[model samples]
Each structure stands twice: as structure tokens, then as C-alpha cells.
Target chain A: MKNIIIASTSTIHGGEYLEYLLPELSKHFKNCKTILFIPYARPSGITHEEYTAKASLAFAKINIAVKGIHEFENATSAIENAEGIFTGGGSTFVLVNELYRNNIMTVLSQTIKKGTPYLGTSAGSVICGLSMQNTNDMPIVYPPSFQTTGVIPFNINAHYLDPDTQSKHMGETRETRIKEFHAYNTIPVLGLREGSWLDVKGSKILLKGNLSARLFRQNQVAEEIESETDVSYIK
Target chain B: MKNIIIASTSTIHGGEYLEYLLPELSKHFKNCKTILFIPYARPSGITHEEYTAKASLAFAKINIAVKGIHEFENATSAIENAEGIFTGGGSTFVLVNELYRNNIMTVLSQTIKKGTPYLGTSAGSVICGLSMQNTNDMPIVYPPSFQTTGVIPFNINAHYLDPDTQSKHMGETRETRIKEFHAYNTIPVLGLREGSWLDVKGSKILLKGNLSARLFRQNQVAEEIESETDVSYIK
Candidate 1:
């Protein structure tokens, strides 16, 4: 039994971090007094303490305490005993590197697999895939491997954006990048846009949010999957 | 004398491949009759032969014969004997991986440093730097290392774009992403916009083309350097 929230972003264009998803999160963590926060993906290279404190502020609104995983000397034991877990956003490379460097990939996955009430955003959501090959972040650091937790079965292209109709930029569009990803790997990639998320409860995974997500598989044209649709059958 | 042409992109918005730079390329190649093409980047994972043909068509416009590195029995020997060299655009990870896998990284750098006419666009141009950390391409595959030729003292963010001011996308802007890169690396990154390029001759590396490029340094505000400016002093 697994319960999880994989969000494309922690914040929307004009919203506060975790503000857009508080309603769902409140219900997801019902009666949960505290949650373990993993700040390995420090967005803009923010310190773990500062990132954790930021997450704490968001969780505080829901009356749930948030603690940084770094607080524990034995991180492995901390996960083993955690009732809930949350991984925040940052560079996926750093996040995955730290996970492998700490030797916590397997245990952390197991804890989440056992239904530890998990939540992930941006880079954090990316680690839920077969590999972090679809991350849009710069390769600021070299990771031990691009491999990540395979809990979600497919990879996620978080914060996915459509091609700007009026832009003059010649850089590859987000859709084009995902198509390139499919050219090499057989894995399906879910283009989760900001404000969109995957809500997983047991074997059911629903596309949650007001917006639709683009799904791309090897050799297939990308298509939008509407919200509220059960995507558990995707894998 | 490291002679090189590092282009931001092979194609500009609504322009044919190499169209915007054909005039510069004609002069860059001068009297050269043929050049070796490195098609390992293979945008959208096109086959070596297919990608090579595409390059041939573009080079033909300038009356230069194009040969794919893969067509030769020994790729290194091809580089060693190349009158001119061109690396095409695609996935930076794949390009770097292939360069290292074929054991051509060292020889390729040596050939360029020895004054062999060289051209690199996008992923190709990125490998001219000390590392491929600043590439905008997706990490569809992981290379053994992120190290590149180090031909230039800094990194290049190919197809550099300004943030969409009126947009609502929450994904990090190109500028913001580079800042994140600076957070971990001290190397300066030159944001080469589409239609812009670096013209390297001997010890001088000049920013060429019609538009200005962005220069980003660690812990500092990024600034725009006008076209034709000799940025060799950036180091």
C-alpha cells in the first residue's frame, strides 16, 4: 500500500511554496503531527536547514510539524522510524547524488513503499521515476548515477511547459526534449505541469489538478491526459 | 592556435540548418575542400548516416565535402587527418559520452588546438568548454564524465534565452538555471544566444554575430556582452 503526492512544482507562478497543494496535503496527512523532510535538492543551492525551515512554514499551516532529515545523526534509522516523509525541490543531480552518497536510496524507497505517506515536489518528484534522465535542471553536479526510485514506474518531466507561440527563442521546446528522451529510452514520461500532480493511493494513481499533463512514450506522438483521470494503468 | 567556430545553434528560429551562419562558415572553412563531421550528438537520436547526410547538405552550400566520423575505420585517425572538423547539435550527454567512448576526446582537442579548422553548434559547442554542465539538452544518457576539451576557459550555455517576462511558467528561467549552476561551479558561463557565436583564432576568442551574449560569473549578476567583443579576458 502506497500513498504519495508527486507535484510538478512546490509553488506556482504567483503562489507560495506548497500553497497550491495545501488542501490536498491537509487531507493526505490527516492527523499527522509531524513529517520528515528531505532537503537534498536545495533549489538555488539553499542550505538544508533553510530549505527545511521553509517546508516547516508550509506544513505549519496544516498544523503538522516538519523536521529536516539532516537533524538525525543516523539518517537510515530516521527513515526506518518515520511515519511520513517529504522530499522538496532543487537540482535533481544533487538530490540523486546525495541519496546514493548517503546509501539511503534502497531504504528510503522501502520506507515509502511501505506506505509512509510520502510527498515530493519538482526534483523530488523526479526521483520517483526509473531515472532522473528527464529533469530540466542543469547538471550542476555529477551524480553517482541517474538511477532513482522506481516506485512510479515512469519518469516525470516536472514543470512541463508548452512551446510559446510568440517566442523567438530557438532552443528545443519541452515537447521536443521529451521526444528526444523517448528516442533513446522506452520509458514513458509524464509531462507534469505546474499546479498538476499525481495522487497515488494504493494502486490507484490519479492525475490531480486543474491542468492536463502531456504524456510521451517511445515512438508515439505526445498527447494530453486530462486531470482526474486514473493513470495507474500507464505502466 | 586553437581555431574554432562555436555557434549557439545550427538553426535559428524559422531558418534552415546552418542558414544564418553559412556566410561565416564559408570564410571559416576558407579553401578547405572537405571536413569530418561528428554526428554522435544525433538530435532526436537520428542514425549516424542520416545525421551525416543532413550535415553534408548544409556543408555542400559552402562547397565543402562532409564525411561522418563513423564512416572511417578509425575515428581517431579521421580526426588526426581532418582538414576541418564539425560537431553537430543534439543531446550533450550523448555527444560527450560518445567522444569519451570512442577515445577521441584527447585527439579531438589536440587537433583543434593544432589549428585545424573546427566548428561546433549547440551540444557540439558545449563540449568546447571545460565541462558540459551548462548545456540545455536533456541528460537522456549519462556520460562517464562531464569533462570536455577545456579549449575555452569557461562554459557555454548554447541557445541562451532571456526569461519570458509576460509568461506564467514556474519552471526556472534560462538565466535562473545558470545561476544555480554558478552556485556549485566557479567557472564562468557564456550564454551564447541563437544567431551568436564565438570566433576563436590563436589566443583570441571574440563573440561574433548580430546579438549580444550573456556572461555569468559565480556569485555575481550576469551581464550582456555586445557582439564582436573579445571575451578572451573573461578568465
Candidate 2:
């Protein structure tokens, strides 16, 4: 059975318990050979050696032999051989670009179909959605602004935040940005707050987090959903 | 002479002011009828009647016979007949959508060729650029995302607020969003902070604002340009 753990972070990453994620992840692989996807970590300007070192720390406790997909020139072999995939967060755009350039999204998609456990955090979690349109990041740095790996039909607004913090510095509020997104298209957006994880095992989508995820549909007010309920109502 | 005014707001009507902009605008419309385009006011959720009243208030003070393009079924007619155009700000996406739907962008391009004064504010300012790729809004609402009128070759990230405000809110920082935009393409972005405007008259691109605007080219560090002299260095 293929299983996926789409999360915002690893460790006490973004106000959530890493231990909680491990329990669910543990069920997927008896001997997890976790392939750490570090596409988002490029923002730190770290060399390949440094990036690999940092990622290794995150998986030190797990029994799996962790490695980054970048170690190989071709990602096809890297993805196919891995028992499980763990995507760490930094920048969603960067991660999506690497995936697109390597043409590994299709292979990963097929692997997910085979029931290989897929774990995505923050920016990593975003690529597993239909489009990155709902992301809080800038959408126009390239020729094609709306492309994704198509793990899900809905867009995931990762690191999902509210608008109540320092209003003056953050520029526009999240609500305003989402509303602006609504003006262009009617795609559903899942505002997955930090510490939240959407577990997809088989066809079931289980929300595992302390807080409820906010859902925005076309011309509709953002509503909250309970953790245990299936996310079939997103569309 | 064709002239345009892309402003942060209409200073005459409680919108952001362009004290430095009026003189330049006046130079372009020496003997032309100034038409004010108010497409961004749709977000107030007000009836057309109420919105027109607000627009008229600004037009009346300028001692110019100003008409809201929204008053007509074909807004392009207003653009076609007017000697010059001034688009006011409210919402960039809404303004772009209305302009696209009415085919006024094509009209505005022709009007500019006739030396019509084309003035835009906020959303209007953004529409003046190559694309709205750098906008600080949400990605879900598309507003015909890639169908910009293409008056300029580069895109503008309007309302270009600084990134220090992230601590106060849960939304992604402005820097992060723009970085995400960079991941998809290599188009240069001019982040126009509040109170700033870019004046492109007969190939002379002037930067008018209290502070410097941030310019990003590819993967390089975003540099700040303080004055017209600094803008000249960009090309």
C-alpha cells in the first residue's frame, strides 16, 4: 500500500511535534531507506556537501539510511530505489523547479501509486498538490507560473499562517492574498497551518494536527475542518 | 500627445498621492482630454452607482471632466476617445480582468502610440508593466495570470512593502514570495514600494518615490535604486 506524509516540517520544525509524524511514518516502512528531498534548502546558498550534512541530522534517529536525491545526476534511479521519500522544507519554488527539471515528478507519482511512503514538509509538501497557486510565495519568476507535480488536485498553502501578526511589515494579509487568488481562478486551497499533516493512505485523507486546516472554495468564506474527518469536501 | 498616469493612488481623492507625478503628467496632456480609468474599485463590493460617485469626487477636484470607464458596457470606447488615460488603484487583479475582458488593453496600447497620456495607480501601475508576476497577492485567484497587456517588458511587484513585517503575521514574508516567483522564471522584477511610481516617457524610465525600489535580476541579490540616476544604470 502506498502511503504519504505531507507535513510542514521535520523535528520540532514549525510548532509541531516530529515524534507525532514518526509514528505515522513508521507504519509505512519496516526498514525505511528514506531518500531526503532537499530542493528547498538551496536558499541558504549551501554547497551540496553542506546541504547533505544538514539533512542527515534530521534523519539521524530513524533506522532508515537517509540520502539526498541530488547525489545522483539522474533522479530516476534515486527515486525508484528508495523505500520512502522525505521532502524537507525551505523554498517550494526551488523544490518544484528541481523536480520539473529532472523530470522525476512522473516517476515519483508512479512510486506513490505503488504505496511507497511519501513524506513532504513545508515547501516539499506544496509540490504534492495540484498547483502552487495558493502558496504565500511569489508566483511569477518564470515562463510558466502554474505548474506542479499533481499529487493532489487542490493547492496547499504551506506554512499556512493567519493575518493577525505585525500587519505593517508583512505587507498584505494572507486573507487578502487568498482573496486576490480567488479573483483569477476558483481552485480550492487548503491553508495547512504549521504542525499540521495531511496523511493520505490508500484513498483516505486523514488530517493529523492540533489545529484544523482552513479550506477556501470559489466565492466561499474560509471554513475550518476537523482533524479526523476526511478531506473529500475540499473541492 | 499620448500620456498615462500609473499611480499608487489618486492624491486628489484620499488614495496614495503622487505629488512628483502630476507635473510629469501635466507635461504630457498639454491640450488633451484626461480620462480616468477606475477598474480597481470592484473590491469595495459597492454598487456601480456608489463606486462611480467615489471616482467622480477625484475627477471633479482636478477640474477635468472625468468619467468612470465602468459606466460604459465597452470601457475601450472611453479609452479610444480620450486624449489621455489615468487608471486609478483599488485591486490589480480586478482591474486587469476588466481590462482584458473589455479588450481595453489593446485600445490603451494604441492610445499610447497616439501620445495619449496613460496614468495608472496601484493596480493601474502594475498593469503598466510587462506582467503582474511580482505582485504581493495570493496565487490562487489567477485574474488571467499570464495575459497582461505587455506595455513594458518587465513585471512590477506592486505595493512593494518591506519584509520585516513577517514577525507580526502568519503570512509568508514578501521576500519569500518574490523568491518563489524567481524560481519559475528569470524575468527582472521591480518591487515598487508604497509612494513610489515608475515613469516611462518616450523611453526615459524615471524612478519617483521617497525611497529606493528593489530590483531583482535572475538569482542575483536584489539591489536598491534610489533615484533616476540609479534607474538609468539598470539598463
Candidate 3:
């Protein structure tokens, strides 16, 4: 069975919550050899060695081999050869750009379709969505926006801080940003507050988080949602 | 028949496109009085008198009366009394913030629903969508994201410039930003270049602009479209 874990962070990195993810992730890859994907770490300008070293600390207790995408020229071979793939979070745009540029986006999409275990966090989590409309990043800095690999129908607003504090700094509020998102198109948006995630196994989607995810339909109020609720939020 | 004109700008006394809009605006309120809604002009920090004075110049030859939303205590009253409403664009987030905070979003929705000649420019045009996810502005600010009047189902990336100037400043390319948008959402984004307007009368949506609009769907290539081609782009 293909197990996909789209999370906000790895090992409470950056003070994010990871309590809800450890158990679930451990259960899915119990005996599998894990390969960590670190595309989102590009913004730190950290070399692959440094990036993977920080990530290894998160999975230190788990007895699994962890390798970064940079170790191999062809990411497809690494992803295909591994029992599971864990994508760490950083700048989703940057990650997606590299994936597209390296032609790994297509490879990853095909790998996930083949039932390979996929684990994503933050920017990694967003890559699982249809688009990144809900991201809290500067639009001027382009990341790969087009080909998300269709892991999920709607865009995931990763690291989504609710009751936004930046409203005074700029103009518009979080709700307004999502509304503007709706004005352009009809795809539903999942505002994933930090610590939240969606786990996809086979065809079933399981929500794992402390808070209820906010859902926005075109020209409608954003609805609060609890985890483990079955929903067809697309369109 | 209620007539509405949504535009990117109004003459700040004199600009290249003042003549084109002034005559049409005058005709929209030929027999009835006119009220120009200057919601997006909040950034100018100009007094209402100054703002109104600038708009009046556009109607100088036509001898038509013009006023801003401040002229009335309630925007609903101003909108109700006017035969036509011209929404001038400036900062989309600012306009949306005021509309959402003052609880005039519904009134605007009602006005548009009643076919009460609703005209919007730039940011104003953005308000017509289900949401503003496609806008070129930052998404950190919160306007009432869920409060757009739903003038249309798709979002508009207004003032959609080529990857010339902004690309140089930001590390990620324009195509990368747009592609990231597609990665996170399934909604079709319309990259409306300047001098473009979508005239909606009943069920028909007519695209009016000097250049072709760019349409993007999830996992699909961005396609350039001809104006007046009735395409079902929002998937």
C-alpha cells in the first residue's frame, strides 16, 4: 500500500508540533528503508550534507537508513529503490522549482502512483496539493507552481498561521487572501495550520492535527473542519 | 439594464486612457446620476474632496456628478441611489479590507446580483472573482478572503506583466510563481494583462484586453487564449 504523510515539519524543527505525526509515520514505514527528500531546504543555502544531518536528528531513534536526494544523480532510482520517501520542509517554492528543473517532479509523481510511501513536511506538504495558492510566502519569489503531481485536489496553505498577525503590516487578512484565491478559481483550499497534516493511504485521506482545518469554497464562508472527517472538498 | 465598468485605473486628472472610460461612463449614467466608488484609493491618503476632484475631471466635459464612498454614511445607500457604480483600482487588499470591515461586501454582492451597473478597475476587477488567489500581490495580508461578491467564478492576476522587471528582482521566475500557484490549487488562473476587462452580461463572459490572457490548470501547460473565445477554463 502507498502511504503518504504530508506534514508541517520534521521533529518539531522550527518549534512546530510533531506529536501527532511520529506514531503514524512510524507505523507506516515499520520495516522500510527510508530515504529523506530535502528539496525544500534550498533556502538555507545548506549543502546536502548539512541539511540531511539536521534531518537525521529527527529520525535518530528510528533504526532506518536516511539519505538525501543529492546523493544520487537520478532521484527516481533513489525513490524507487527505497521502501519509503520523506520530504522535509523549508521553502516549498524552492523545492518545487528544483523538482521541476531536475525533472524529478514527474518521477516523484510516477513513484507515488506506484504506491511508494511518500512523506512530506511544510513545503514538502504543499507539494502534495494541486497548487500553492494558500502558501504564506512572497509571490515575487517564484517556486514551481504548475505541476504538483496531483497527490491532493486542493492547495495546502502549509504553516498556515490563523488570526494572521501580518495583516497590520500589509493589507487584507488571512480570510481575505483566501477569498482572493477563490475569486480567481473554484478549487477548494485547505488552510493547514502548523502541526496539521493529511495522511493518504491507498485512496483514503486521514487528517492528523490538533486544530480543525479551514475549508474555502468559491464565493462562500471558510468552514472549520475536524480531522478524520471524510470529505470531497475538490471543486 | 444596469451597466458596470471594472477597470485598472481612473485618470488622476489626466492619463492616456481617461478619454476611453469617461465617455463610456457618462453613457452608462446617461439619464441618471453617477457615483464612482473609489475603494482602492485608500493608499493615496488623500482627502475625500481630493479624490472626488480627481474623478470629477474625468467627467468634466460630460458634466456628470461624481462622488466617493465617503460621501455617504453607508456604502449601501450610495450604491442603492446610484445608477452606475465605477470601482477604480489601486491596492486590491486595501479596498477589500475596507469593504469587509465595514460590512459592505454583501451590499456589493446584492448590487451586482441586481444588475446594478457595477464597474471595477484593477483591484476592483479582482473583487469580482470568487477569490483573489491569482493576484500578483502578496497573500500575507488578510482582506475578507471569503467575502468577494462572486462576480465571477475565476480569479484574476491583474496587471499581469511579462517576466521582464519583477523576475530580475526576485530569484524565482514569473513562470515559477505561476507554476507554484498551479501546484497548490486546481483552479484555473487567468493572467489578465493590462487593459483587460471581462464584461459579464447574463451568462456570457466576454474577455476584453489588448493582449491575450494566460490560462493555467493543475498539471497542465499555461495556455494563451484569444479574447472573445468562450472557453470553459475554470476546472
Candidate 4:
């Protein structure tokens, strides 16, 4: 059975890092004394050490120890041995590149499938989907491929925003970008708003948290899936 | 001498398509009777013919005929012999993929260097840089390479926006996103605001329009460069 939590963001507005989700994460990452942290995303270009420290402090409240993957000599072995695993958010490109570079993308996926508890936020959460093609992050670095863990059937557009009716900005809205993605890809995409997460246990993926998620499928009207509904059949 | 107009956007807010830049474009492409338009970006997934028709409609106001590169049997030759060229905005990934697929990236670069009056908006202007790493568009498709025409010395963040102080969204701001880009790459980046553009004339790259553009270089604080100032020396 697979156990995972794919969150839209690590921090919500006016909240501390991972503060809003600590209660849920505590339950999600329970039964583990220590969890390995993958800090490759390095949001805002922070060093791996610095990013890991933040994750460590947040997990400390849950009485779970946190160790960065970089601390281990063998990253693949680190995932294989971690009681639980959490990949922090930042640049999805950088995270995917590092996962491929460290040769742990497959190992990590296997570890989670073997029933190790796993948590992902933002860029980290996006990788749980079919591909990184729907990510909103800039291509800070080029990865070998857009393929991800595919633990879930569809792709994720984390930190998804609704169109601002008052804004004068001419940039494409989140919905528009995902529609463009559907133009070339047939994969379904979930627009995961901040504070929302998917609770995956065994083969069931439930939409958790307060807000509804926007589900987009090829040639179909985008619909809002209510929280706590099973989205495992989205594909 | 190289002659190019790299605009931040093809359409400004509440304005007709290319309406704001018509006067400048009239003078920039004055001698050309017809210009080849590359509709690879295809905003909203419109067909090449439809996108080209939109461009044709816009350029007609300036009395310059427009033809899509897709209309030509030999895209390379079409770019090589074009009296002028215009690449419209859409998904950067798709445009770059089609450019490489069609094997016209280099030929287009060489033609623009050989002084065929050229114009680019958004994704098209982005490719004028060394790489397409700085675009805000989603990676709907994978390209052979992130490398693009080095017509401009540095990368470009087109349709650049300032941070919104009132937003409650937790997503990374445009400024934060660019800062993350500087972590792995040292290339300079210009945040061209909507309605603003870069006028590339030989060795001179001048900022045009009313607004100042944000310039980001590695290990340095981002600064705003006033319009009408020469930015060719950035790199």
C-alpha cells in the first residue's frame, strides 16, 4: 500500500512554513521517528542545508526528526532506508533535475510504493503526478525528462490561482495555461489551490482540506471537485 | 546592422492587438512589403492558419502583408528570404519545439543577424535571448533543447510584472521566480513590462515605451532601467 500527502503549498498566506498543515502532516507522517528530506527545490535559491533546516524545524513539532538527503553519502540508499520521506517545494525544474541527477527518482518512487510515508508540497507535490508539464514554476534548469513519479494518475498544477477579474496584467491565467497543456497532452490536471492536499492511501486518492480543487480533462469542461471526494478515478 | 523589435506583449490590457506598437512597427518594418510570421506558439491552441490570420490582420493596418512559416514548404528558406519576420506569442515550449523540429532556429537567427527587419512578442521575444529558460509559460511539451537564438546577449523575462502587495496567494512572485533563475545561471535578465519593448539596432539595444524595465544580473540587486536607455551593455 502507498501512503502519501501531496499538498498545494508548504506555507499558506500569513502562516509559518508548513504551519497550516502540521496537524494533517503529523497524522500523515506518524509512526516514523525520523524522515529524510529532499531539499533540492531550494525555493528562492536557498542552499540545501538552509532549506532542510526549515523543514527540520517544522517537523520537530510533530516529534519526528528530519535529515536532508544530502546528509547521506548514498541518496538512493537514503530513500530506501528512510522511515518517511518529504520533498520540500521550490523550483520544480531544479527538484526534478536533482532527483534524476542523484538517480533516486525511481528508488524514491519504489520506497513510497512499498508503504513508506511520503509528503510533498508545491514543486514536490507536482512530481507526484504523471508529469511536470503542468507546473507553474519557471524552468530554472532543464531536466532530462518531464516524467515524474506518477504515483497519481493525473498531473498537478500546484499553487493554482483563479483568474483575477480586476487585474490589468495580460499574462495567461492558470486556467488558460492548463488548457494549453491539454492542447498537446491528454493527461488530466488537477488545479490544487493553496491549503489543499490529496490524501493517498493504497489506491484511493482523496481530495483533502477546505477548498475545492479544479479538475481539467481533455475536451471537457473544468469542474470543481469538492474536498474529501475521491479523485483516484480522475484519469 | 541587425534590426529587431522585441516587445513584452503583442496585446496590452484593454487595447486592440498590437494597437499600441503600430506606429513604431510601421517605421521599423517600413521598407518590407510582406513579412513571414512564425505562428508556432499558437496562443489558445489555435491552428497556424488562424494565428497567422490574426497576425495578418494586425500587420495589415501597417500595410505589410503577413505569411505564416507553416505556409512555406521550406521553412528555412522562407526565413532566409523573408523581407521581414514576426514571431507571435503563445507557449514558449511549443514554439521552441517546432523551431527545432522544423530546423529553422539557426536560419532564423542568421537571417535576423543579416538585417531582415524582425519583430517578436512574448515567447518570440524570449527566444531572441540565449535560452528559453526565463519564460513564464508552462512547459506543455518538451523541446530538444532549452537553447535558443543568441540574438540578444542575455535572457528575457517578457511581460514582466511587479509584485502585488495585496495578493493573498502564496505562490512565488515574479521577482522571486527570476531570483531563483539567477541561482544556476549567470545570464542577465530584463523584466520587460507590458507595453515596453527592446529596440535592437546593431550593437545598440534601447529600452522603449513609457515604463521602466527591471534588470536582474547574478549576485547583484535588481534595478529598474528607464525607457529610452541603452541596455545593450547589460551582458
Arranged by TM-score with the best first, the candidates are 4, 1, 2, 3
**Candidate 3: misplaced stretches above 4 Å?**
A11-20, A41-43, A140-145, A164-170, A232-235, B1-235
Looking at model 4, what is the TM-score of chain A?
A: 0.98
lDDT of 4 by residue, B142-230 (tens): 99999999899999999898998999999999999999999999999999999999999999999999999999998999999999999
Tens-place lDDT per residue, model 2, B43-131, is 42344456556655555445455566767676667777775566665555566656776666677777775766677766667776667
Which candidate number maximizes DockQ? 4
Alpha-carbon deviation at B6 in model 2, angstroms: 4.1
Q: Residue A224: error of model 4 in Å?
A: 0.6
Q: For candidate 3, give the DockQ.
A: 0.05
True contacts kept of each: 0.77, 0.50, 0.04, 0.88
**Tens digit per residue, CA lDDT, model 3, A73-172:** 7776776777778776655556776777777787787788678788887777777877655665433234444447777777777655466352222234
Better of 3 and 4 by lDDT: 4
TM per candidate: 0.98, 0.75, 0.52, 0.99
lDDT per residue for candidate 1 within B1-235, as digits (tens), equals 8889999999998899999999999999996899999999989779999999999999999899999999999999999999899999999998999999999999998899999999999999999999999999888988999999988999999999888788888888888888888878899999999999999999999999999999999989889999989999987
Instruction: List DockQ, one per candidate, in order.
Output: 0.80, 0.33, 0.05, 0.91
lDDT of 4: 0.94
Q: Residue-wise lDDT of candidate 1 within A126-150, one digit each (tens)? A: 9988899999989989998998988
Q: Pick the candidate with the highest TM-score.
A: 4
